[model samples]
Target chain A: MEILNALINITDKGAGFLHSIPALLIAIPLGAAFLAPILFKLWKRLAEIITGLAVTACLVLAIYLVLFLGNTPIVYTFSGGNWEFIQNLLPLGIVFVVDKLAAFMLLVVSILVFFAYLFGLKYLERFTGLGKYYTLYLLMFTGMIGLVMTGDLFNMFVFMEIAAISSYALVAFGTEPEELEAGFKYMVMGEIASIMILLSIAFIYSSTSTLNLAHLSYAFTQMQTQMASTPGFRAGFYFVLILLMFSFSLKAALVPFHSWLPDAHPSAPAPISALLSGVFIKVLGVYAMVRILYNVYGFSWESSPEVFTALIVLGLASIIAGSLLALNQKDYKRLLAYSSISQVGYIILGFGIGNLFALIGALAHILAHALGKGLLFLTSGSVVYRTGERDLGKLGGGLGKYMPWTSLTYNLGALSVAGIPPFLGFFSKMFIILGAIDLARVWDSDPSKPGWTMIAVAIIAGLFAVVTLGYLLKITNQVFWGKSEEKRTLKESPFIMVFAMVSLVVLLLAGGVAFFFWLKPELLGPAADVLLKGTKYGELVLPGLFGAGG
Target chain B: MLILGISLVLILIGLYAIITKRNMIKVAVGFALMEYAVNFLFAIIGFHKVPGMKIIPPILMEVKTTANVLSSYSDPVPQALVLTSIVIGLGVTAFMLSLALRIYNRIGSFDLDEIKRLKG
Candidate 1:
């Protein structure tokens, strides 16, 4: 009897803890972010400090949650206080969930935001509207955290828009002509994408009669089996999926849909650019794509040939197109932005290959890209700060003479991103290539099919690898090694900016060195598991209080 | 069905305006209109034959006690989603307007041709 009572108590406590996970991570940041603008009125510096503290607290909590929470999912639900109908349709109310995958993303996003905020302390001094900047920054941070944490698909869309909208405003913070133009173009495209996403969601809800992601996944599976005879229903479902993929691809800035990125990333302030390239696109675009495709749709490259083909084609196009575009860019930041597109292609290719090693490689590359790209953008920001020049042609040689630390950090970042050995990028690329060869071997076993297609794709990916190295080397040599014709003197950027860049460089090196020791178990392993057992997500997410009735 | 038709027409008009309008401001306005059409479509998709759909969800006890309310209502999830979508639209619209204003201030003209400062 004593043992039975103890078991009952344990279950009760587990239930309570699971319910609180979302409120702890999402609600706190969201509330703090909303109140920050008002708090700024009392004390400007106080507001910034408080926002940073909240994000740091969030990061610590996320790490703890990831460590302690078992494989089971956590759900948090909120019902309207008085309305009876709303309680029945819990989907109408706000809901948040933090599963293993989302919690891991939360950790990455919080770390990036924490550093960006620290960097912003000094970097944002020249820009007007300090309070407004912090407020929006925190708000965007809150949205990103929420996006990663939420369990509801519609809620995900809401958070996505919140982050995207803030990013559009942040990009044009300078109010310069080019900034405004880029901001406008980005806003228009973003709004259209949101519209497409909403339309898809509406269709999905109408079809499934549920808004909860896990519940919808179960419903979709049921429909897939039951409606096998109904061609129209299948067609509608596929159409919604396609719309979703298109919208997310637009946000991800995948090859054909990436017209706005090169302009917007360069136009934004450096910290914002870092946040945009480092975490924003990943969380909003890549993360969502992975979550929806793997969790909700139950896609596997082996099972879903069409989906796999689409992913590979898109990946190849982004790789070749982004590289070719970067090859000719003269502006310093624009070149980096184009390079981001190419690197994102690498991540996509790794994921699409759908092998265990390749998926892990993709997640690892994501971390490396974030650090490398973040460092490079910060360095570019410093260059702009010291000289007020963005055109690479106008920039003279021997930038390292003035700022040796920045030059070294920037060079390390460039090398890492170019996939040089002993860096994080090299290991990730090796894994992807190995996975590709494994996939080719598998295809070859089937004598009816041709392995040439995958072989060609792999060759193209390798060629872009070289192109990436070429441009990065060219930029590094031109900026840091060449002599200036004008004979101008340059000074180092603010201490805070240099610190941020160096810190990111250290992380890039550390991540590369400690990939197996640190990153694999914490991030890559869990992410790979999530994608590998895609259909099992539905099983894990169901069986909760608000779950679909079996 | 009528609402769907209207939304389709509005979307086509918005696309035309975005493609043909020389003024950047007008193009932005076109995009805004297109967004509105989508928002309307979302609202319509969530609409049900029954009336008195509650936007706010009630407590669990009330849900257990109430019978007619649960059966005679539309799904409110899409409406809530649309509210969020509308708010996001507003934020983006505000940002786009500000960008247009800044562009005018910088270039002294609202025409796309005049704001050709950035070259490929």
Candidate 2:
């Protein structure tokens, strides 16, 4: 009851403005990125120090927003007041809207990025062109935060391109022949996806003369009500929706569209591998799709059966294929990359289930995978940093005995990812299956009637859950605790590297335990409700719909 | 409708080249083709034409007399959007071209099939 009152009180103060908080989140990192080279020229180590300070500041701001905004969304127009003044003048202008979900993603992105930067501090010592690397890193960082915050469609596209372009450069940052090949492939696929999305945006802008997300959703809802029976309108509308979904799914790397992930992820440096696997796909792919499809276009399993069914099929295929393919990998990072694909399957599955618990489960899985896979990748980087080798066959032999910190953290990550208890991944995977069962029971008409489809989905997911455990265990045994191989001068990683790994482990443990006690109900619940509320999103973001379509 | 048809045809040609071509440079060219097609589509979307309506460029020469500029001219927002999109596309094309050159320098082949070093 107290929490509800606090939430209402926050929402009551809806048009809260606090001195340009939203713009600074994007501008700080971007300014830092642009200035990094100049700083590098001035002093050798000042660029790194400034980047560290800037990212930490962003993280602080994100955490502050999560607490201060509470549950109500705050929309910031550049003019520092309510959007009503511009509502009558220009139909749409640059707006930054931060709601529960956006806040949650900001938190996740900031946390991961801060740690990734810390990890990169020591990790990039041997690499050349350190200034360019930091520049691209901060640029990608700015792009991720901006895409989530902006309330304009074309703005979102621009940020998406910024992130994509930087990531392509980062993937090939290693500059090996294989790394260049992977980067080129990733760029081509990403370009095609961006073009499709832009084309769809053009279609939307043609139908409605506004590019603002709030106005667009309002217009869409109005149009659907007015022309619900017009076949031509419906056909064009669904066509646009289909194009948008296809492009986003390609970015998300769902099933048939998943060729680039396995290649791009392994080719990058470890911290980047962590970022690409952790938040990049979730932000640029799944997050954008969910916001546009569910909130703007108003997709529901009942309303959009074809779309939901396609999602389910794609999710299932990714799970089975990603895991099975992971079984045959010889390289360590490649296997982890394949595992990432399968875990993304779990997130897609949760989204397709289309209920509260499922949404929460999916959101939780995003955080879990970011932490677990991030820890695993950083550990891989530490191993490579210690000894320049990556093959499981050549690099075995009781590695745990020498590096206790890496071994213990790696084991914890493996257990969590495999969905073991007292760890975060277990709860998320369990909630998704439970959500599936609830959906199945609700959809079935009679009490005694059987729900075969949802039941089969749950069962298949559960079975593959075991397969996930098997492969993780196999890899863990091979990498950390196996027969001795070639001996050399190798010790635990440097202090800074171990410090980053330890911090991740602590987060993983706290997140898992906090799942039962607090975070599920308070944080994830509100975020999921934003999705569940659907087109009511318009009301929350934009106060009125009268002048939306002009 | 004719403009839309032309855009689709342009996209298909680029798709065919991207799918069937073996040379890296050809793939890059195909990408450029697709970029222009999408840009052209955005330009078409922003355009408005009535059969008898006068066509005028969107300029503010007579701001007081023609305050309601929207009714007098075709929309220029999509034109502005396309301009920005085209510049970004050029950046992507240049980057892709450079990457292809680097790959050629390292692997000594423009054929994608021969550049099969990192496979399962």
The residue ranges of model 2 lying beyond 4 angstroms of the native Cα positions read A1-19, A79-84, A88-91, A225-227, A446-450, A546-550, B51-54, B59-70
Candidate 2, position A109, lDDT: 93
Off by over 4 Å in 1: A1-21, A80-93, A485-488, A544-550, B1-3, B49-71
Please give, for residues B31-52, the per-residue lDDT of candidate 2 as tens digits.
8898899899888776556466
lDDT of each: 0.79, 0.85
* DockQ of each two-chain model: 0.60, 0.76
Interface RMSD per candidate (angstroms): 1.6, 0.9
lDDT agreement of model 1 with the native: 0.79
lDDT for each residue of candidate 1 in B1-120, tens digit (9 for 90 to 100): 688789879977887887788788898888789879888887777655535544533222234345655544555656766787788778767777777888888888888777655555
Q: Evaluate candidate 2 and give its CAPRI docking class based on DockQ.
A: medium
lDDT of 1 by residue, A1-550 (tens): 4743443453343575545656666655776777777888898877787788788888788777778777766655555565434432344356666777777787778778877777777777788777677767877888898898787898898889888888988988888888887887787677777778877887887787787877777777677675689888778878898999999889989989898899899999888998898888888888899888888888886557788778888888888989988999999999999999998888888878888877887777777788788878888888888888888877867788888887898899888888888888887877777778778888998987677777787788777889999888777888888776776667787788788888887777787888889778876788678778876776665554235355
Quality of candidate 2 docking, DockQ:
0.76
lDDT of 2 by residue, A117-144 (tens): 9898888999988888989999999999
TM-score of each: 0.90, 0.94
**Model 2 accuracy (lDDT, Cα):** 0.85
Candidate 2 backbone collisions, by pair: none
Kept native contacts, fraction for each prediction: 0.73, 0.76
Instruction: State how far residue A182 of model 1 sits from its true place (Å).
Output: 0.8
